[model samples]
Each structure stands twice: as C-alpha cells, then as structure tokens.
Target: MAKSNKKTKKADEDMSKKKAEESKVKVEAEISNDTADTEENSAKTSEVSVESLKSEIDQLNDKFLRLNAEYQNYRKRVEKEKNDIFKYGSEKLFVEMLPIMDNFERALSASEQENIESKVLDGIKMIKKSLDELFDRNGVKKIEAMGMPFDPIKHHAVMTVESEDENNDHVIEVFQDGYALNDKVIRPSMVKVSH
Candidate 1:
C-alpha cells in the first residue's frame, strides 16, 4: 500500500507539471498572435497614409496644371492687348492730319491755274515734296491704285468703266488717294474699275 501511494503521488506531480507547461505555451501563443495582429494593423495604417499622401499629391498637381493654364491664357491676352494698343494708339492723330492732307491736295491741284507764277509753282512743289517726305517718315504710304489689279481689301470701286479686254477687271483710275500706316491700309483707295 505504501508503494502504491508513492506511485500515485508521482503521477499527480507529473500531471501538474504537464498542465503548467501547457498553460505557459498557451500564453506564449496568445502573445505571438497579439503581436501579429499589431503588425498587420500597422501595415494597414501605413498603406492608408501612403494612399492619402498620393491623393494629396494628385490634387496639388491638378491645381498646378490649372494655374499654369490660367497663367498662359493671361499672358496671351496681355500680349494681344499690348499689340492692339500699339497698333491703334495713333488713330486720333492720323485722323487729325487728314485735313492737312486734303489741303495739300488742293494746293497741288490749283498749281495748274493760268495765273500761277513760276516761282509760286516751284515753292508749291517744294512744299508738297516736304509734306510727302514727312508723311513717308511717319509710316504713312500712299496706296498704288492706278493701272494695278483690283483688290477689294485695298481699293474701293466708285465706278466701273467698260473695256473690251478680259483682263480689265482691274483698277483703271484712282479718284482720291488712299493711305497706309506701317503696311496696314488705313483707308481704301477710291478707284474706277474697268470691266
């Protein structure tokens, strides 16, 4: 009976030791699982942060592109406005000079009067030449309308003359001179076309 009691005690101790070891192993496994879950959560958070940063970058890039496009359009508009200002800035000045030009034309036509003296004619011719030189220096040019091909952009037909030639659909005469400023026609030539 004593031997049997000793054997049962040994068996109980062994079973207790086995149960303790199993409990330790279970605790360790739970800790490992918790660590793994924490690592997975950390990875997911990092991925979310990366996606957020990418979205912000995309938004910034879009804003940059929009601003760039707006700046480009603004530059173009400013350039076009500057060009228009330069082109039309002298319109009023040129308009005011028209009367002087008309007077010059009258003086030239009256120089053919019967009572005009030679010295007076020479003086008138010098004045007219000086006026023409001034006009040329100020970017003013006279349109060539007589004996040239008819161009609606530069010539206005006031009358039509009958002609037998087919090539007569052209300018035959200019009644009043036309002027241009820097290669741009300010006024079309008043012309008679042959037809």
Candidate 2:
C-alpha cells in the first residue's frame, strides 16, 4: 500500500510540472505578440507625423511664392505709373497755350498786306517761324478740318450751311483750328457743316 501511494504522488508531481511548462509557453507567446503590435503602432505613428510635416512645408512654400509674385506686380505697376506722370505732366499747360499760338498766326497773316517796313516784316516772319518750330518740337500738331469729313470726335459744329452737294454734310469751313499733342486731341476743331 505504501509503494502504491508513493507512485501516485510521483505521477501527480510530473503532471503539475508539464502544466507549468505549457503555461510558460503560452505567456511567452503573448509577450512576443504584444511587442510586435507595439512596434507596428509606433512605425505607423511616426510615418503619419512625417507626412503631416511635409504637407505643412509645402503649403508654406506656396504661400511664399504667391506673396513674392504679388509684390513684384505691385512694383512694376508703380514704376509704370510714375513714368506716365512724369511724361504727361505738362499736358494741361500745353492745351491752354494753343489759343495764344493761333492768335499769333492770325495776326501775322493779317499783317501781310500792311505797308510795314521790310525789316519789320522780316522780323515778324522770323518770329512766326521760330514759334512754329517750337510747336513742332513739343509734339503739337494742328487738326486739319478744312475739306475733310466732319467727325464729332475731332470737330465741333457751331453752324450749319445749306448745300446740294453730297459732301456738304462734312466740314464746309473751320472757324478755329484744333490742336493735338502726341496724336491725342487737346481741342476739337470749331467748324461749320453743310446740309
């Protein structure tokens, strides 16, 4: 009976040892699985952070380029405006001097029949020539209205005359010659149109 009891006790001890070995294997497997999961999660998080940073950098670069372009455009626009102001600043003064120039031309033309001395006539002619040269140099040109088709854009009709001719609707006479500066009309020609 004692031997049987000892044998049973030894069998029980062996079974317990096998159970402990199986439990240890299961615990090790769980630890390994947990470590792999942790490593995968850490890698995913790192990749996301890197992508987010790259996107932010790209957006900032785009903004910087746009701002630089805007600044360049603004600088160009200001420079162009400044040049224009400097070039055309005397436009109003030139326009105001046109009537005086026309009066001088009329006075010289009327004095052609006077019994003036030859020297005085020559001096007047020289002055008229100088005035004309000055006007030419300053880009001042006369608007030719005589015998040309009347255009409201360049001529102002102050009176109308009756005529049977087809071309009569155009300018019959120019009362006051117009002037232009640099191809732009400074004053419209005062004229008479025929109907």
Candidate 3:
C-alpha cells in the first residue's frame, strides 16, 4: 500500500509541472504579441507625421514660387510703363509749339508773294530749313490730310461744304495742319469736308 501511494504522488507532481510550463508559454506569447502591436503603432504614427510634414513643405514651396513669379511680372510691367513715360514725356510741349510752326510757314508763304528782298528771303528759308531738320530729328512729322478722306481721329471737321467733285465726305481743304510724334497723333488736322 505504501508503494502504491508513492506512485500516485509522483503522478500528481508531474501533472502540476506540465500545467505550470503551459501557463508560462501562454504568458510569453501574450507579451510578444503586445510588444509587436506597440512597435507597429509607433511606426504607423511616425509615417503619418512624416507624410504630414512633407505635404506642408510642398505647399509652402509652391506658394513661394507663385509669389515670386507674380512679383517678377509686376516689376517687368512697371519698368515697361516707366520707359513709355520717358519716351512720350515731351509730347505735350511739342503739341503746343505746332501753332507757332504753322505761323512760320504762313509767314514764309506770304513773303514769297510779297516780293521780299533776296537776302531776307534766304534768311527765312534757312530758318525754315533748320526748323524742318529739328522736327525730323525729334520724330515730329506732319500729317498728310489735304484732299484725302476725312478721318475723325486724325482730322477735325471745321466746316462742311458742297462739292461738284467725285470725292465726297473728303477733306476739301486743311485749315490747320496736324502733327504726329513717334507715330502717335499729337494734334488733329483742322479741315473743311466736302459733302
């Protein structure tokens, strides 16, 4: 009977040992799973933060480039405007002097018929020639208006007259000659239009 009791006790001890080893294995497996989950979560969070930072940087870069381009375009436009202002700055003064030029031409024409002295006429001609050269050098040009079609932009109608000629609504005579500077009209021709 004593020997039989010893055998039963030994079987009970072996069973208890087997149960403890199984519990340890289960605990180890759970710990490993928990650690893996923590590492995966940390990696996912880092990836999200990195992606967010990259998106923000790209957006900022795009905005900077756009502003730089816009500012460059603005500067170019302002420079062109300034150049045009400089180029046409003298237009107003030249327009004011056109009437004096017309009077000079009239004076020369009258002198031609007045039987003026040779030396005086020569002096007037030289002055007129100098005036013409000045105009030519300054890009000032006379508008061709006489006997042509009347234009509202380049010609002002001072009088409308009846005509027997074939040209209708045309400039019959120029009362005042027009002038242009650099292809831009400084003054419109004062003219009589034929009906």
* CA-RMSD of model 3: 4.7
Return the lDDT, model 3, position 62: 100
Candidate 3 to truth, TM: 0.69
Give the Å shift of residue 95 in candidate 2.
Answer: 2.1
What's the C-alpha lDDT at position 168 in model 1? 83
Ranking by TM-score: 1, 3, 2
lDDT per residue as tens, model 2, 1-195: 999999998888888888999999989988889889988989998899999999999999999999999999999999998976766666798887887778777777777657556776687778778877977887778899988988888899999989787886789898898887777788999999987
Query: Across residues 136-170, which tens digit of lDDT does each residue of candidate 3 receive?
Result: 88888999999889899899999999989889989
Query: Which clashing pairs does model 3 show?
Result: none
lDDT of 3 at 167: 91
Model 2's alpha-carbon lDDT is: 0.85
What's the true lDDT of residue 170 in model 2?
Answer: 87
User: In terms of lDDT, which candidate is strongest?
Assistant: 3
lDDT of each: 0.85, 0.85, 0.89
